[model samples]
Target: MELGLEVLGFLLTALVMIIEGIAVVMSRRPMHSILFLFLLLLTAAALFIELDAVVLALAELLIYNGGITILLTLAASIEPEEIRAPRIKPDIILPLVAAVILVFMISTYKFGNVSNFSYTSLGTFILSGYGILLLVVMVMSIAAALSATYMISKEDVGI
Candidate 1:
């Protein structure tokens, strides 16, 4: 029963990931594409969690979903209101239905039996070994965002 549940979870996550990925590519508007990308990253994180890679899942959520998606959304919003495409009414019902189904699936799955994964050791390894690399990446991302913002502001000011 547990194995069957795991397989089902994996399949559902995979299906969502694939659909969101295609949405990301096919979305006409920049904001819509970014939103789909966020969903894709979220499903990928969920897949990592199902595979018992808790640290990886967390990293995916923090770096891609939390950081990159926000950056892209900010960049997309830089477009002038007059030049941007007309807003389309989003399909709220579909997303709400999907969320409900996902919640139901999650509620039925047993999460207490998660394997003994040592988060502390993994943290220690990441900080001790690749700390500098992580720091560099974070700094670069921040710098990129700031530069993009500055450019947008400069354009607005006729600079």
Candidate 2:
């Protein structure tokens, strides 16, 4: 009975993620798309929790849902009138791509030994070998945020 409930919960979370993912792609407005993306990431974090990857779940919530989504929302809010207009026509390609990704993830979940995955080991490996790469990525993210802030300030100053 417990296992059944877990499976049901997992399936429901996956369904919600798929729907929100589609909504994110189909949204005509940038803000609406960002909102859907936020929800999708939240669901992804829940999925991680279901998989017993608590560290991953926290990182997903903090990094993607908290930081990236807020940054994107701010970027969208300050877009120029011409740029705000939706340029990409709604197409079937996005949904197809999402489906493919879902399939791939499901297959990986079924075949991969997720129980053996250790966040501590991964962290150690990254810190030992790719610490510089991680530092560079953080620097780049900070630079991007600063650039966005500068652009927003300049626009406000009528520059």
Candidate 3:
């Protein structure tokens, strides 16, 4: 049935998100972390699609996975030798605390069914009433790309 498939999709999305989060936090290399973060963004986009938020899913792909991830990857590659050096002492406390907080939040919240909201109406509002938010996201993505390019080029000549 359709309901069973929806439930399976939700479970798969949650599982992917959890694994991606762990991989992002655990990876020592900047590029690996960025890759995992990109995967997380993709899984989030999948969740948006499952909820029938087509516009949001597209924005998630284009703005986040496409723009921000590329910027992050480029920035990571431009890091100095000292910046890429491994830490003498790995700090695990902050990540553990964050994980605990995330678990607590998840356990305490009640997740509502996606059918509770009308996706069509949300899409209409996004396209009509709150179209400016979409524009802002695009502008921000462009700004991030431009800044990253400038910084990388400047640092190339030790400027």
Candidate 4:
């Protein structure tokens, strides 16, 4: 039963990741793409935790979803309408490529197993000043976006 649950979790995580990748490609809006990317990071973190990679999971959450996602969202907000409407190229082979890779990963790889490495040993490394600065930037940017979204929702300014 425990092993089955781990498998289920792995499958769920993979499904979310694939959707996120497809969303990144298929979405015309930059904001939606960033949102999906955030979701992808979240799911990946969850996967890491399930695999006993707690250190990596925390890093994924902190760096990708927390810091990078806010950066992406802010960039998208800079030119909302313009960024929303992107010129999509026609007739790409992304679907086929993604499908093949997905099959290969699922078939050849084993999921739901304990990670071979020790996560605790990796956590002793201190984050550098640049990493701290990036974290601060991510927090500020997300806070600004939250305030802006609230203000826009409550009080609309006619452009």
User: Which candidate's TM-score is highest?
Assistant: 1
**What is candidate 1's lDDT per residue for 1-159, written digit by digit as tens?**
466766877777777777777666766788877887877777777777777777787899899989999988987898754344524333752385358446734664456656566565876888899999989999998998898789877866554
Error of 2 at 121 (Å): 5.7
RMSD of each: 4.7, 8.8, 9.6, 10.1
**Model 4, span 24-125: residue lDDT tens:** 788787776676666667667666666677667778988897898897787768874753454443234335434543453355344555468754444344
Better model by lDDT, 2 or 3?
Answer: 2
Better of 1 and 4 by lDDT: 1
Candidate 3 versus the native: TM-score?
Answer: 0.57
Give the per-residue lDDT of model 2 (tens digit) for 22-71. 77787778876887787688778778866868678789989998899998
Question: Where does model 3 exceed 4 Å of error?
Answer: 1-3, 81-159
Given candidate 4, what's the lDDT at residue 54?
67
* Pairs of colliding residues, candidate 3: none
Query: Once superposed on the true structure, which residue ranges of model 1 sit more than 4 Å away at CA?
Result: 1-3, 80-105, 108-117, 127-159
Candidates arranged by lDDT, highest first: 1, 2, 3, 4
- Scanning candidate 3 in windows of ten residues, the lowest lDDT window is 85-94
